[model samples]
Target chain A: MKTIKSLHARHHELSDTHHQLEVLNSEIFTRHYLPTFREKLKTSGLLPLKPTGIEVFQMNVGYMCNQTCKHCHVDAGPDRTEVMTKETMKQCLEVIINHTIKSVDITGGAPEMNPDFRWFIEELRKEYSGEIIVRCNLTIILANGKYLDLPDFYKKHNIRVVSSLPFYNADKTDRQRGEGVFAKSIEALKMLNKAGFGKQDTGLILDLVYNPSGAFLPAEQSLLEADFKRELKDHFDIEFNNLLSITNLPISRFLDYLIETDNYEDYMEELVLAYNPKAAEGVMCRNTISVDHAGNLYDCDFNQMLKLQIESKAGTHISEFDLESLNERNIVINQHCFGCTAGAGSGCQGTTT
Target chain B: MQKTYYDPADLKKFGDIAEYGQDLADKFFNWYNDVFKDGALSSREKCLIALAVSHAIQCPYCIDAYTSDSIKRGASEEQMMEAVHVAGAIRGGASLVHGVQMMNKAKKMLM
Candidate 1:
């Protein structure tokens, strides 16, 4: 029932992206005789992974979140103060206006916590009528009075609301997210349902994301989706469009957890053994560019979190965006990428394979 | 050489039995995999059943395998524990049911 602090607030060493990467690339991996991700990729003939194109332009609006989930890769929490300025939003708007990008994914500690979040979305709607995804931590809907109308706002913009509900029940969901997140999430879902977000023929898409609560791969997506649908309908009378099964990549808080629980070596081994070439080919980074709160760009969200900027010749900021050079750049990859390529593969949209 | 009858790692080497008896092992593995596939019972249900049976038989390797398998199949913790209770009840009942014969013998001798 107690709140946990973010790694940044606690001054945990893993908060340093360099330290996290070193832990991921530690000698224990080689000592255990596990193959490096790059070696595995090369064996699969996918070394020097390149971009297919940019289809989704993901923006991390800020790191100021209401809740500090245990497995957060971004380490977002209320204690954090980093937020995106309107100037940065304007720069992103210019890129959106110029590029033929089909989707814009907005994510954050709690993106709605940003002061200018609504303004940015309104501006995006004006110039770009593409698919806009808001990664809403459902609890945020009930976090404050001002956020009470988020569901209606989303429906108005025709936003695709992708929310994380780790499991269908409270015990499992609360264990991962927080003490009472599942209850809040269910309430939030009901409100979204009332707003016709997940209803049939509403033209409003409400997708739920499911990642394992511990150090393990998720069950098959379609099977898990069926279970979520049956259980939610039978128990809570809630409905949603799709369930995206995501594999928890070893990074940030999750990586710290692996070490603390002594599951690091075994987990990394599992991921290595389950590496799928098909999944690697369909990695979201192949067709996505991630923009940080400060307007810096990276190959994908994970890369952005690690500060692995894109290898584009054009430039690494939205103000100097160039699709041609960006498309030609090789994606920045590391051991953590195995999370995306293992088993059926995982991305923001779910399984890649 | 292993000092004990079981090595946790041996579970991974299960397929190696094919080296000694390829035909039998192949048929066994094929049937085993097929048996677990979705049919009369959902694979999730089968996994829970397997978990219970593994506990009844007290196979360490099987207990380890089915525990992870059950989670991977999306079997809830509550359902999994209940399955084990089912196995425990049957095993306990099997022993208790034999007491009827003892009672019948005593009645025959006394009467």
Candidate 2:
């Protein structure tokens, strides 16, 4: 009875609030919502801020991959034919040398699947000599006869490999990936470890990536990493450096999935209600540039999917890169940005601030 | 007998917002299969995060779906609890930061 009464009273309160908001919104404009005015008025505020240094260079070598993961904002897959040529990589080297960039992060469907994959890595090593990261889908190491030597190759360059092992179990792993993927992933991780990938102070920097298979943000990094460590140790004897819990952005294949499944509204509402300015302030776009397969630049990879192109052509086609224009470019954002600016925040490299 | 499913009431305010509310809910359901598409993160892992997030902001529907999802994702009792703690810390920090509002208000009145 009390619950019913309270609910009824709550309905009355909401109705009253809605009526007041409607009046205020009508009096103001056709907005029907007044809170959004602050956003429109943001430039008037003197909360002076500056962009963080581009310490990480997230370079997209291509969209080719050995596996097709659903949450992939990159939409990379084995069927993808996009590959960055050597000339484009050379241009990236030029930007790294000319700019304040300090690290090189190479990502793809399976960054290792490109025919020029080895050459690209070799060239990057010769030119930059800075921190170089490869986002490896561990199973790629065992995908086919062609990729069998990747574990060894990665160790040769002392590459900091950030791979994905969604969970330590077989059923869940297979459910997200495909059949027999969990066993192969375990085999792949063991191979990487033998090649000194995730061993302590072996200095190979083997981190794991974690993302929810549904419509919510990721859990915190430390706790999830701990659980992963314990589970992998007890069961499959897998070890790693860290677990990166990334929030799934609502765009592209993901947007299509949400609409098809009917969880779009609740998920978006959840994200908006959980909006955290600290997360916003520390969003990765403040530092990184996401390059597409064609070499067009975006503030972050997520924005790239939404077609939010950088104001200026920083690196147009590997053939024509303008560092001056790249540095002067303004980052684009949209409502989907709420994904990054919520809770503890998320990014490719893991938690931000 | 499941507690905390989806409530349109909580989401009514987000009705017209781009990429959220009803459409996003629908989108989430469709995207469920896509999210599990072969890649780095597991479907179960994704479900665990979804469920924890549901609890973090008190989304009953998400909580219900993700509770079953966490289990289906093969998340152990311990693992699920750990994810909850992660959400706990962030949500806690979020509230504590907003204490700034109370602090500023107090300072203004006192000073």
Find the candidate with the highest lDDT and give its number.
Answer: 1
Q: Where's the lowest-lDDT run of ten residues in candidate 1 chain A?
A: A28-37
Error of 2 at B20 (Å): 30
Displacement of the residue A148 alpha carbon in candidate 1, Å? 0.7
Can you give the TM-score per candidate against the true fold? 0.97, 0.69
What are the per-residue Cα lDDT tens digits for candidate 1 across A58-176? 99999998888888888888888999999999999998889888999999989999999999999889878899999999999998899999999998888999999999999999998
Q: CAPRI verdict on model 1? A: medium
Candidate 1: list runs displaced more than 4 Å: B3-5, B19-23
- Model 2, position A233, has a per-residue lDDT of 84
DockQ of each: 0.75, 0.05
Fnat of candidate 1: 0.58
Residue A195, model 2: lDDT of: 88
Query: What is the alpha-carbon lDDT for the whole of candidate 2?
Result: 0.69
